[model samples]
Target chain A: MNSYPVTLKQSYSSALQAYLADAQEAALMRAYELGRQATENGLGVLDIAAVHQEALTQVLRPSSPSQETLQTVQAASKFLAECIAPFEMTHRGFREANAALKQQATQLANLNKELDAFAYSVSHDLRAPLRAIDGFSQALLEDYLDKLDAQGVDYLNRVRNASQAMGRLIDGLLKLSRLTRAEMRRQPVDLSATAQAIAEALRKSQPERRVAFSIAGGVTANGDPVLLQVVLENLLSNAWKFTSRHATATIEFGATWQDGKQVCFVRDDGAGFEMAYAGKLFGAFQRLHGRNDFEGTGIGLATVRRIIDQHGGRVWAEGAVDRGAAFYFTLEP
Target chain B: MNEKAILLVEDNPDDEALTLRALKRNKILNEIVVARDGAEALDYLFGTSVISGQDAPLNPEIVLLDLKLPKLDGHEVLKRIRADPRTKLLPVVILTSSTEDEDVVKAYGLGANSYVRKPVDFDQFSEAVRHLGLYWLVLNVPPRSKGR
Candidate 1:
């Protein structure tokens, strides 16, 4: 029952009065001006309709002759239609903006694909020069072991080590970039089996690392098996690596029902990170520990996040400074 | 001991030299023939290089093929090798960087005997070269020369 904007109400009343006074084209012209003013005042179609109805009710006399009332009603309808001209124009404006937005989206997608191809080509070619550097450094060491002093040999070895480190970086970045470009195949994958297999392989790779894995059996998920495997590999390997200092540690993997959806988590009792820097943990090349304490390219969690995101899931981490770290993800429809 | 030459189809001079050094250090004493491009490799195998005045093809005991090259890349060379009856059975081992590379899968599909990822660490790479030499040259017997 509250009145509309006072200025809109006043202008609408005057416009109707002028229309009734002569029913001339000039009087109706004021109706269009009223619409533009209404829009400027942030009045919508509903507000304008309210204003028109109230103005017409006041202009009509209940005691008027039927003939005069009919004429007044017809004139009032025409004025209302004219007053909504700005609303129609607003609709057309939205449609055109939407079309432009869609076109730009398509252009952006094409540009992203081109960027991906360029990055892939660059990463592919980068390996050759890196390999040559390492190979030549090795050649220097093997071919001239006795001719050079220990310091020279050490320098050559260092060169080889640096090149190999770059190789690892390139590999990590390549894998990271390809996550988006690769075609994903969704299937019913036995996550437990994949986790067990990864655990077995990790143990085989370094048998001296004492760690116990507690993985739930029959854990399945509908996703791209190859991609899910990558997620588990990165997460589990992170757990295995961070726990290297402990004589014995525990790593757990399983899923649980959280708010009626399946949430999977990987947890390890290892050298955990601070809650303050937890946000930076999933960023590429963002490391929390020094290289001397831990060896990683800081790509593992980022890889996990990307794959989970591709699967329409969310991933997050929780940890303290020294207790341990736990990563959780949810896959839902 | 296999006396035939080993054809190395490589475009990068650094890779070519490194492969030579790796194989030589591993006691792969077979004569190593270098072809700098895919076309040159095809030329050596088909013996069609009239400019070089070679009339007969010298079949290598094994071909260490790289994926990327200047002309006719590795897959094209592999296809031609399989297409021709003379060199169809030639044992070609692919040298790649990583298993993640899809090119390795395509290489396997094109009838490669084995693939060795070239590790950036020199010692690991040397070990890989040694294993390849041991597997192909010493342990496994080469197919009898086909009426050459």
Candidate 2:
């Protein structure tokens, strides 16, 4: 049917004329229905007021008696007030919702500021004590080595190792937080080159691991280069770590079509996790493997998920116990 | 006072002791002048207060400044150090635990000669200080002080 302000104007004129001619309750209900229909047709309060003014000029002619004109004006105001009632209620609803939304926004802004201060203190103040623990332990090992027995020396070494491991954990935590807060500069990023660079770094880190890398060329994306690098580094490094036990292993980096969209993937024939534990993959510090099996702070997949989420993409995994694992992700805007 | 003493501006006693030991191990045997806070650092460098017990500012060979300090912070101290004509060209190296990008930007913007995060691993921290000492003190030449 026709949905226009012209329809509203015509309906409003007829309703007012009917009400003036009959002076009945049914006529007043028509005036109310006209107001509701005008709102539905996307007409504003001013538009309805203009329609009502036009109707009044034609209804009240100068030839009518002055006393009769007074009565007609008063009676017509009753119908006009009923018509304007719906518009006032809608405006009131808008004001309430707007105020509530503003209040929620203010609360969120304050929470963000507090989180920034907390992260700053954690970065600056917390490391000093950890450094002192590691530094003093080193001093004891260097200066009092002759005084301590073999077992005592071993204990000191353990203390130093524990402190250093804690240092690594703190560093990892800082890195994750920093990446989330970092400013993103999105551009066309070369995913193939990014994956290749990470693979090279991993190979150089452990030259004895006889791992084969099958990275597809021309894999590209539109995302923040630095953040996309983090995603590839985490996934590839995880692949490299899980495959350390094998004398020789193969890892692949490529993309494929999924539901009519391009999806990037990293797959490895490594110590793949069971499908039962796959639900815990993207959580921070979530690990399906034991520490002795693979040494990690359990932040790699979590970091990858965070970056992908910020890019408005989704990440998922598929694996079978000891068979292999494949990670698929998409980058949109 | 006339000796090319090294001024160490630090707040934490542990870091102060650790840094001193690191420097001494590197054979940086210059006379060390330690200021425990930013205000004391300014007092020693400008003779702003009688607490330092020097008649004039003790222009050290280098100032190893820490960012987080009591009474005054590192950035404000660097601002004042660069503001004064006598100490404007003084070499100030920021040594702190913060690797935050904004802190790095602010330090360099305020005329910091170098920025180094105090590594948690003592071996790496020791090596970093050793190279730092050899580079800034032995190799890098200091300009003649304008306050002279």
Candidate 3:
């Protein structure tokens, strides 16, 4: 009957309306969860978008859907899309930032490699001409000694000395650059034994000088033996050199606990530097004293700083002018 | 017996002059043949060019080779000399200005009889040359030549 058909249509419309509401609620919940998960996992925009499209399809695919149901599905899909817009933008920003960081890392590595190659070539090429200059000066001195006056010979000697000093500078520069390029191998190094040996050598070099050395026994550190030796040599030699003018100097190589960390120090009773110029102490070619007053290339402390930095350590100096200086360094365990 | 001859392979004219002067100062007094580059050195040793067109090939007692050369590096030249049966045991000494550790290890690995770093100090250089000449030319006897 016509009445029965109308009743049946009414019931069907009510059921479809209820089903659409439930579907919309469930889809919204799922979308909220997906957005949360995407944000947590740092999921890409395209990946979340694909997942969202699949979810929308599942939500939209209904058996015997009416015209009103189809419209609701379209409306729900648009809402879900808008909901994910903020997440998509955030993911895009993260991806771009990560890419930029990777690019910067690669650029830094390439620049370091180029610097190493430049240093190597400079060491090789520069030494050749320097050797030539020094050698020819020697030849002139030996062969034409009688032809030239004493003043002329003295000038040639000065030239030779200057070239030799330049050679030492080049060698120091090469060593400093190599420290940056060389791979570090860490092991337990006997700091006490190394310090004692260096002190012995320094004493032997100048037997006339009376310097008391107190090296702490059983002091150990984890670092490259060769590099650590270089560090000690520079520190101890600096101590020895600066203390030369003293009537009797005392150099102490010891380690003490400071702030729950082992701090190693090289202390000397000699001509210390002013606190004002302390900032310039570790810079390459930075000399507090005149070249005439002290013979040095001023690259030693710079090399020390570089080596310590490579070892993941810190170094600093403390002193007053004309007073003794104490250099302290610490290595990470 | 004819005084033992020496082959001085050096490309840099200044280095060549200094080496020659050092050798003379050390009183080496041996017949010295100067080759300007690696190719010329190979030519002299292998008897392949105008320098080696005589009836008999020139056989030097020792070869003082510089590392950096024009055509071939000292390592490559050393490898070739070691590969050849005639010059394999020719007492080749690597005499160069390179202080690089890799150069030293490579030279020795390539079967170099001696690896000497050319000192910057002329006096030390002369002293090193004196010791080298005394040791290689006079003290240590060379393997009998195949031609001999």
Q: Pick the candidate with the highest lDDT.
A: 2
What's the ranking of the predictions by DockQ, best on top? 2, 3, 1
Q: Which residue pairs of candidate 3 clash? A: none
| Candidates sorted on lDDT, descending | 2, 1, 3
Q: Tell me the tens digit of each residue's lDDT in model 3 across A178-272.
A: 77777899999999999999999999999999999999899999999999999999999999999989999999999998888889999998999
lDDT of each: 0.85, 0.86, 0.83
DockQ per candidate, 2 decimals: 0.53, 0.80, 0.61
Best candidate, TM-score-wise?
3
TM-score of each candidate structure, all chains considered together = 0.75, 0.80, 0.81
Q: How much is A203 displaced in model 3, in angstroms?
A: 2.3
What TM-score does model 2 score on chain A? 0.71
iRMSD, model 1, in Å: 1.4
**Would you list the rank order by TM-score, best first?**
3, 2, 1
* TM-score of chain B in each prediction: 0.91, 0.94, 0.94
lDDT of 2 by residue, A172-287 (tens): 77888788777788899999999999999999999988999999999999999999999999999999988888888999999998787779999999989899888799997887
Clashes of each: 0, 0, 0
Expressed as tens digits, the lDDT of each residue in A1-333 for candidate 1 is 234478788888888988987899987888998888776655677677777766776676555647677676767766776778787679768867988999998998799789877767777788889989999888888878989899999998889888988889878888888887888888899999999999999999999888999999989999999899999999999999898888899999999988888888999999999999888988988899998899988888888888898888989899986688999987664
lDDT of 1 at A283: 92
Q: How accurate locally is residue A48 in candidate 3, as Cα lDDT from 0 to 100?
A: 50
Query: Among these predicted structures, which one has the highest DockQ?
Result: 2
